[model samples]
Target: MSRQIIKDFVYYFSKPLPFNLLRKLTGENFIFPFYHLVADNTPIHIKNLYPAISVEHFKNDLEFLLKNYHPATINDVLAFVENGKKSEKPLFFLSFDDGMRECYDVIFPILKQKGLQSAFFINPAFVDNKTLFYKHKISLIIEALKVTKENFLVSELMVFLDIFSANNKQIIETISRFKYSDTSKIDKIGKILKIDFESYLKKEKPYLTLSQVLEMQDNGFIIGSHSNDHPKFREISEFEMQNQLGQSFNYLNKNIHPQILSFAFPFSDINVPFSFFQFLDTKIKIELSFGTSGIKKDVLPKHIHRVPMEDNLKNATRIIRSEYAYFLLKSIFRKNTINRQ
Candidate 1:
């Protein structure tokens, strides 16, 4: 059977019976769930690449979570790590990543209406539309090329990017490789295709602005740093990792004055060095950090794992139930997989 079918089966079956029984028998634990963007519909320019949650579906997920779990903030998790204090009820913290502007528009209103709190983890470079992520640029260029069918020398692009591919899929694969370190080159390629990223930033305003972030903070939303630039943590050097941590936190400290310093890894923390957490704990005073690895435990208690809730097939409660069911099954096999460091 396909994994989705299995997960769906687990989701449905556990939702009605096994989940309730398991929770009553074993008790409930904390869950951290996250999303990237929540928009009414995916924008034409980036629809091919990223998935966005419709506002209606987002409301549904929130409503589901509110019904089954106690909503939490980063501050609450921070206190839990510091003093071993946890809520008596089943708790879940909601967070959004990459500092997308939609969080300000669609997400904030919904959160406010529900009287719940969430953390917005933003890249320092993206605030105020200073620069665009290369992944977004790739989509914009692809969209422009699809419209104009701009015929540039594919060979030249391959040579410039040092990639060995001749197909459209290869071209996208090559572009994805230039994520953090060499985005300027990607921007140059986009410019060659007559797709101006800066102009898009000026006009589209795809990212959160400083003032918008400040207003959200004032309205009881938590602002946490994702990074200075969103890069896969495993791909960067220790020095670069430290710099990302320092610069991002410093920017938030200077502007937001958040009570506690919190950060979420740009991508999954699969290959991140163990030393990085040491720096965060000892030198940086990081209260909380997050990863999107879905119902797992981290080496550091303060480093929380959040399930990605952007998948449309699963609602928040369904995702939680799946996690519990999967974890329970694994536990029966003498596998403590969820707490893998």
Candidate 2:
């Protein structure tokens, strides 16, 4: 079975165990739960990518975390990591990626009502709806294909993707697999499908604007860089990786001027080298860096592994319990902590 399938099976079985019991067994008192966005209606840019949690589900997630884990601020997390600060209850730090408009429109208000703080990581390229992420462009093209009935266009798309015999589903699967390196192909697909991503950006205002980011910062929410543009760090060279971080950090310092320097890897931190963390510590002076490696410890003291709360649209209860269960399972094989090379 695939690793995900095994995780799902474990999650299914683990859900019946009480969360507190699972938590105690895992001996974990700190968690960083993160999401891309939250909305009642799925936006076209994100619909094909992953299911954005509904406002109601997000509220439930908050309620559960607040009940079981103390909501922690960025400073709290820093203290815990640096000084081994302990709380009576375990701590949970909330954060959102992608700087989606829903963060300003829907999410922040809800967080405010409950007196919670979170970090919002954004790509400098996509800020103020100036451009769309390439992945989001792929999503828009896929959505277009679903609604387009043009036979000639479909045939052209299949030819472009080099799968002339592909069915509609096959074509979408191909498009969905397009990586950051496939930007040219994604652009061509958008052209062929007549899906203008710029128009969508202008019309939808999908990402948070500079003004919105400023307001969010003023409201006690921390802001950080995801990158200059969201790219899979594993695919890029060391130089390109450093450039990405440098450019985004420059932008954040010049424009946002956040109190603390922080980052979350755009896609993940898998295969990232130990040297990179050293660079971040010495050159960037980043206060914190995060990865979506779920319920694990990292060898680098400053790097944190955050739980992705949106797995298969599961709630906090199931996801957290499953993470703990999976952590224990991995522990038996001595694979729980992340050791960078």
Candidate 3:
């Protein structure tokens, strides 16, 4: 069976354990849970990418975390890392990626009401709706293709994508596989589909604006860089990676002026080298850096891995339980902690 299927099977059978007990069994006192966005209605730019956690589900997650774990702040994380600070209960640090507008419009009020603090990671290039991420462009293109009944248009799109014999599913798979370096092709796909991403950006205002980010910062929420334009770091060269971090951190310092210099890898931190962390330490002097390698430890003391809460469309309860269960399973084979080259 596939690894995911085995994990699903384990999670299915592991659901009987109480959530608190499951957490204790994992022997991890700190957890970082992260999300892209939460909404009552799924947005077109994110619909095809992954399931957006509903507002109600997000609230339930907060309630569960608050009950079982202390909500940790950026300062708390720093103290824990620097001084081995301990709490009576385990700490859970919540964060959101992509700087989506729902963060301000929908999520902020709920967090405020609950009296919780979290981090927000943003791409400098996409802030203020100035540009759309290339992945979002693919989503818009796919959405457009769904409504298009004209066979000639489909034929043209297939020809342009060089998948002239592809079906709807294959076309979407091809478009979804378009890399960050394939932005030009994505733009061409948008043109062929008559989908104006700029128009969508103006109308939807999909990303959090500069003012919103600043306000969130003022209200005790941590703001961090998520690279300049959200590229997969492994695919880019070391020079490009440095440039991305430098430009984004420069933007953050100039615009947001956040007290903490933090970052979360755009896609992931897999295959990232140990030298990169050393560069971050000596050059960038980043306070914290995160990756989406769920429920694992990292060799670098300052680089932490976060649990992606949106997987399998599961809520925080199931997701957290499954993560803990998976961590234990990996431990048996000594594969739980991530080691950088």
Candidate 4:
């Protein structure tokens, strides 16, 4: 119920990105720069609950993220795949999937200064123009539905599930079973509760503005597609997949930049097929495709693995030095074979 537990809960729940069984498997540990990376901005919803993050620390983390972690480009991934030659630098890709406004103020400058490279996988639906998305639309509905005098209300979270009245257990179970790199359930629940994704961005104080993208690109960072309309790859159909992936391409290329070299499978996980990536990788210049699982190699000439950092902890530094992190990764290094497979 307290903040500490919530923090512990986030750390415990969010694993594999930072720690895993791989240490037991290979005895070689890889530093995951993407795993449990701290975001620059404070989400309006969670700001009140946690302590203020030092903007200085955030900046420093960004610097470390770029220098200590991150791949040179998609070519790095391709190299790992083809040559199996381990790039001396640990394979870390600095990625901010949602394209938050903070990327402009907090992250971009640091990247630009270091002459470092990272990818920005954005949802074009929420670009400069505000558009209604299912998640935001639902939030709008539920927000209005509630009768509250305080600025924010803490409902049983379960109550929110009851709104759809469509088998909360099944839906929650469906959702709980899902594990991916981004905030899938949050966006999905937002859509479910009639929160308009784009409009909600407008309503919220902070979001990635289109100008941010132009600036980041001008600074030498790569831009990529998140999705047109964010959809769970496991739940959606092939036509849906095409449309979803296509929308990411259509909007990003049309509105942001057509030459986007990458595509991040929204909530990519165990259920989704590798074939979903086939078309995008083969035809389009999408040389990079990001997902959570199944990546165990070094930076190659193609795509690479990223550790999905979340907001479950109060102390950001703990992510790199937590017991779980030490055990999971230390075990990896002990093994003779670096499973940069």
- Tens-digit lDDT string for candidate 2 (37-116): 99999999999999989999999999999999888888898887786433446899999998899999999999989889
Candidate 4 residue-wise lDDT at 17: 52
Per-residue lDDT value at 14 in model 3? 82
Per-residue lDDT tens digits for candidate 1, residues 252-321, read: 8898898668889988887777788889889888888888877654547677778888665466667777
TM-score winner between candidates 2 and 4: 2
In angstroms, how far off is 12's CA in candidate 1? Answer: 6.4
- What TM-score would each prediction reach against the true structure? 0.88, 0.96, 0.96, 0.63
Off by over 4 Å in 3: 83-88
Off by over 4 Å in 1: 1-18, 22-28, 44-46, 73-75, 83-87, 153-165, 333-341
* Per-prediction backbone clash count: 0, 0, 0, 42
lDDT, candidate 4, residue 166? 42
Candidate 4 lands at a TM-score of: 0.63
lDDT of each: 0.76, 0.88, 0.87, 0.52
Q: Name the weakest run of 10 consecutive residues (lDDT summed) in model 1.
A: 332-341
Q: Give the number of the best model, judged by lDDT.
A: 2
Stretches of candidate 4 off by over 4 Å are 1-32, 35-41, 45-54, 63-78, 132-147, 150-200, 203-205, 258-260, 294-303, 314-317, 320-341
